[model samples]
Target: MSFRPVKPLALRTGVRWKIAVAIAAVGALIAVTLSVVVHNAARISMLDNAREVQMERLLFAQRMYETSKPKEPRFGTKINDPALPAQLDQLMRDRRRGTFVQEHRNGGPPDVWAAVPLANGDVLSLHIPFADRSTAIMNDLDRALVIGSVSVVFGGCALGVLIGGQLSRRLRKAAAAAGRVAQGNTDVRVRDAIGGVVRDETDELARAVDALTDALNERIEAERRVTADIAHELRTPVTGLLTAAELLPPGRPTELVRDRAQAMRTLVEDVLEVARLDSASERAELQEIALGEFVERRVRALDPDVVVRVVHDSWVNTDPRRLERILGNLLANAAKHGKPPVEVTVEGRVVRVRDHGPGFPEALLKEGPSRFRTGTSDRAGQGHGLGLTIAAGQARVLGARLTFRNVASAAAPGGVGGAIAVLWLPDHAPTNTGSFPMLRLSN
Candidate 1:
């Protein structure tokens, strides 16, 4: 047979078991301690009582020897041997009628002898063995102690089970209610789950949960109404501006107007996309793609001169449209905010876009993307901040991570410091898990 190693007390025992075992153990310890102490105390008391009786008998024998003037000691039938220990004899000889005691020996029956000097200067010694009645009484005490200890332990265990079960039930109900709230049920009520009017910490927790749910519901509804109003109010004006710009005479100014109008339309579309992402309504139509080839093609489209490196050829399942948007925004940001020689590298499921520039603004890196946050003091009139924001939103929808950091300049050519953007896509889709070999597909 095999046995599992002992686990920690907390882990091995349930709440109920822990409580029961704790009470039982403490009770058992106290019971055993009291029993041992009581047993020893009773035994000592019995021995002391027996010793006192023996001394009285020896005193009586001393009186009889003095009055009758007997040559040999005269002890009652209760005493068998009438001899004093050498130490007791010396003490009685010196004191003349003083009390004396001898050590007990291990034998059939525990006995002790006492010596006393008579009035005529003759010492009288008497031996007295403990009665069978004393032994019988001690045995009865031991039996009673065992029974009482067993009763106490059982009572402690029962009380612990009752209390522990009630407490565990209340806590488990509260926990289950919290779990439902986390699962988006939002309708879970702890008070209802517990089915009690009692006021406690658990009830307070339930009330707090309800308050949080209401606040979240209100905030989400307000955001939805605001987003709808903005979309409705801006779409018409942006459309009219684009239409009006197209009517202008053919010239550089007309082209500029059209471009600005198109940019406005793009911004409006991005706002709607962001709202959808926030509401978690945007779903990805995932597809398996060769990540190295995909990243190479996207980077080359953005900048023909930019160097691209594919260290690994791995397949990832992601929405290509969202992936393209994320890559395009990153490339555009790099070109606009960073210095030349932008590099894109793909390794495993990670793609890194780095630029030899002063790096991202501290606020942008720390607080993340915000609307209209053009980086640094010199580049104040840069593009609107929606590009990185949209990129971040799209990455989230695709279940990927986008992060930015500044690196040491010594690593880059000309010893120029720069910012790096890292995007990590999931390695494989839940439905597809096939291996793809590495290939050099970047220029």
Candidate 2:
């Protein structure tokens, strides 16, 4: 009844976020560097211009004193009586200077002070306060640089996010296509399905996945053909052998021959069925059936001693024949390979069969059911390993999922982990629109 929430593709982390952050960082560095260079150059140019204007006024004031000989002469348009600082006046009086310019605080405010001697030996001095015109120009430049740098940083970050989203969406699409292919849906051709117009690395990756899935589909098809042919070819001979064994006299040798012949026939049939399932040739006949009663009947028919527990009562639409085959194989596997007290629990749409055995092999859990991976544990040359393979195949055809895991056996003294085979079926018939959740990993 409950399903885990699937995680969505992320733009805040992984390759997307990394790419965005890297690009933004480089842009921000460039912006800061340019702002610093431009700010310094503008400050130097403004201050230099201010110093030149101050010097021109000082020269004009000296000319005014020589021509008019006024008591107090206004130097230039912006200059009042050019007052000399004490240091510059002393330098002029000592005759230790010609036309000169210097920058100092000089007990007042920071300014650029210039002194020029008059024809009448009067030293007219000029001072440009550092905080007046030049400081205002520098402050305006500072604000503009700050704003420009911030704009560049924000613009770069936004562009990075946009580009990151585009790239991440492409990659996520390809990844999702590959996931479906891995889950046995080999029809996924990523390049053809979601390939972009402009070719890039993402397109290259999608093409690679397309090639891989195509190759796998061809190989699987070839294998399926071989399996089906061999199974069909063996069916007749195996039937003849069985008939011949039955014609023989009643004895141990005759019984052994008949039993082996029957097993070979069953193996051939299972192989053919698997081939059919692989080729998508099998179809399910769905009907609403009582879940509790149907499972109890199947469990009793297979092994009366096996325990059956019905936790929920519900009707499900599924093929009864295929369902029986799946349940039968699971019960047979537990009987042959697992310890005693096999238990079947039907909860919701899931039927779990637990056996008190040494559990499934690690390889089996990692790699689902394979062809002939039967291990020699308790019995020598007992199981052919096709039971789970066939069960899993049938489960797939029925729009169900079959999973096997190992469960703890704490109550059983001296007992180890036990094997648990789970068969999950959809509650209703699959729609033509899309697929239902087929499988879930057991916790």
- Top candidate when judged by lDDT against the true structure: 2
Count clashes in each candidate, considering only residues at least 3 apart in sequence or on different chains.
0, 0
Model 2 TM-score? 0.80
Clashes of 1: 0
Please list the residue runs of candidate 2 whose C-alpha ends up more than 4 Å from where it truly belongs after superposition. 1-12, 61-110, 113-126, 195-198, 375-381, 409-416, 430-443
Residue pairs in candidate 1 whose N, alpha carbon or C atoms collide under 3 angstroms: none
- Global Cα lDDT for candidate 2: 0.78
lDDT of 2 by residue, 297-390 (tens): 9889889999999999788888888899999998888888888889999987899999887778777889988877785454223667888998
For model 1, give the 10-residue run with minimal summed lDDT.
Answer: 429-438
Mind giving the per-residue lDDT tens digits that candidate 1 earns over 1-443? Answer: 99999976664556777888899999999999999999999988887888788878777766666567444567552222336556666777686533333445654556566666555565566666667898789889999999999999999999889877776777788788878766445567766886666677767776777788778867976886698579768989999999999999999999999999999888788777767666655667778899999989887887797889999988887778889899999988888888888999999999999988778888988988876688777435467787888898787667678998887777765454888999988754222122232346799
* Candidate 1: stretches off by over 4 Å: 1-68, 71-214, 242-266, 360-385, 408-417, 427-443
Overlapping backbone residue pairs in candidate 2 total 0
- For candidate 1, the TM-score is 0.55
Predictions: Cα RMSD each: 11.3, 7.6
